[model samples]
Target: MNAVSTTSAERVRADLVRARSARSARESLIKGLLFLAALLSVATTTAIVVTLLQQTISFFGEVSPLAYFAGTKWTPLLSGDQQSFGVLPLLWGTFYLTGIGLLVAVPCGLLAAIYLAEFAKPKVRKTVKPILELLAGMPTIIFGYFALTFVTPVILRDVFGIPVSEFNGLAAGLVLGLLVTPTIASVAEDAMRSVPQSLREGAYGLGAGRLQVALRVVFPAALSGIVAALILGASRAIGETVIILIAGGQSPSMSLNPTGSFQSMASFIAATARGDIPQGTLKYETIFVVGFTLFCVTLLLNAVSTRVVSRYRQVYE
Candidate 1:
């Protein structure tokens, strides 16, 4: 009897060992696949950086960086006397558009998020949130056309009497604001929702009003995430190409007036791509330089988002 029991115990032990070994093998395989996925992303980013840098070097070889940075005009394809390579005008155009977009988006999106997070019933949020996010899925070119046809003619020119031209930054910026509203609202709503319910309850228990609790308790707790959402919205605003290209015009000029027509970095790139710029020419190289500049700006925004999130995020047990 003792010998039989011993044999059965050893068989059970061997089976358990085999099961653990199989699990170990499966885990190793999953880890390897995850590592490969990470490597693929890294490799793609490296390739983009290398390609941009190589052509940007060619651009600098043709033009002085000082002239590129300081020159106010961006007429790179004109005759000898007309040609200039000033980058600031286009950069400023982009900044102006993004600022206008934020000006419109920040208030509307935040207010919408506050309503949805702190005041809306569950059914109302469930219905409204999806509808709001649906705006994000619309084609960008369609938004461009909407800006051109509706916003320029109906809103900025007529309703507000802003004196905006047919192709102006004001139209593009306004439409871009509507386009980015979903992103800001969704992200901010999620962040506000993530605030601890206990904190909200405690505030309510202390006889705090809904507005006061929302502002004092939840808003500060989720501020890092709110800032991140705003950064992402700004990033979307800056990276927009189609709307600015179509509605904001393709003519590069330096002017701060939102009512004026101007070209963004993205619009400039698109304009050049469609024109007579020959391959490997200075004009072509300028595109890569502009692209690199846009890349740097985007990277900076992402870094700021990371810093804000890490610095102010609240810890909960």
Candidate 2:
């Protein structure tokens, strides 16, 4: 009996050891994969930065930095007298479209978020939210076509009597606004929904109306996330290529008019990249210079978003 009992105890100890060892091996494999994923991400970013810097350095050798930045004309692809490297027009068009997009997106998106988070019933919220988010998944080219074929001619020209060109920024800006609205609405709604229920109840106890509570308490509490969403939408608008290329046209304009034809940095990069331009040319290097500038701007916006979220994000127990 003593020998049998000792044998059973030994078997149990061996089984436990084997189980733990197997678990440890699986954990080790998962940890290694996670580390590799992180390393790959870092390596990819570093590679992009290095490539951009190399090409941009080459570009600046031919073009002065002062001329590239300060000059108001952007005709690098043109010949002789028409070849100016001023990036301001592209920058202006980019921000002008972005501004128009924000004008349409912010109020509509915030209102939708507020309605979904604070006013809507569960069924309504579920149905509406999914439908709204589906806009983000639609192909951008489709949006461009819609703006060109429908919004520009029928809506802007016929209905509104706006003297928009066949390809103009206003229509593109409106559609771009529609494209980024889902992002803001979704993110801002999530932020507002995450606010503690007790806070809402406390506001109600103070006889605060639903609108007042939503605008005052919840909006303020979720401001960090809302701002982050806004920045993200702006980034998306800035990076949009196809819509702007198709609807906004390729005309680089120094004027900040949304009703006329304009070219954005993204549109310029997209249009130029598809051509048969030879490598090592000044025109080819312009792509990388503009791309690097865009990358820096986006990186700065992301940094600001991170700072804002870290500073003001409310932590609820």
- Alpha carbon lDDT of each predicted model: 0.91, 0.93
**lDDT over C-alpha atoms for residue 239 of model 2:** 91
lDDT by residue for model 1 (1-317), tens:
99999999999999999999999999999999999999999999999899899999989988999999998998987869899999999999998888888998999999999999999999999999998888878889999999999999998878988888999988998888989988899999999999989999999999999999999999999999999999999999898899999999988777767787888998888878876668888878888999999999999999999999999999887
lDDT of 2 by residue, 1-317 (tens): 99999999999999999999999999999999999999998999999999999999999998999999998999998899989999999999999998998999999999989999999999999998888888778899999999999999999999999998998989999999999999899989988999999999999999999888999999999899889989999999999999999999998997756788999999999999977889899989999999999999999999999999999999999
Q: Alpha-carbon error at 55 in model 2, in Å?
A: 0.5
**Each prediction's TM-score against the native?**
0.88, 0.90
Top candidate by TM-score? 2
Residue 291 of model 1 has an lDDT of 93
Q: Global lDDT for candidate 2?
A: 0.93
| Model 2 pairs whose backbones collide | none
Candidate 1: residue pairs that collide: none
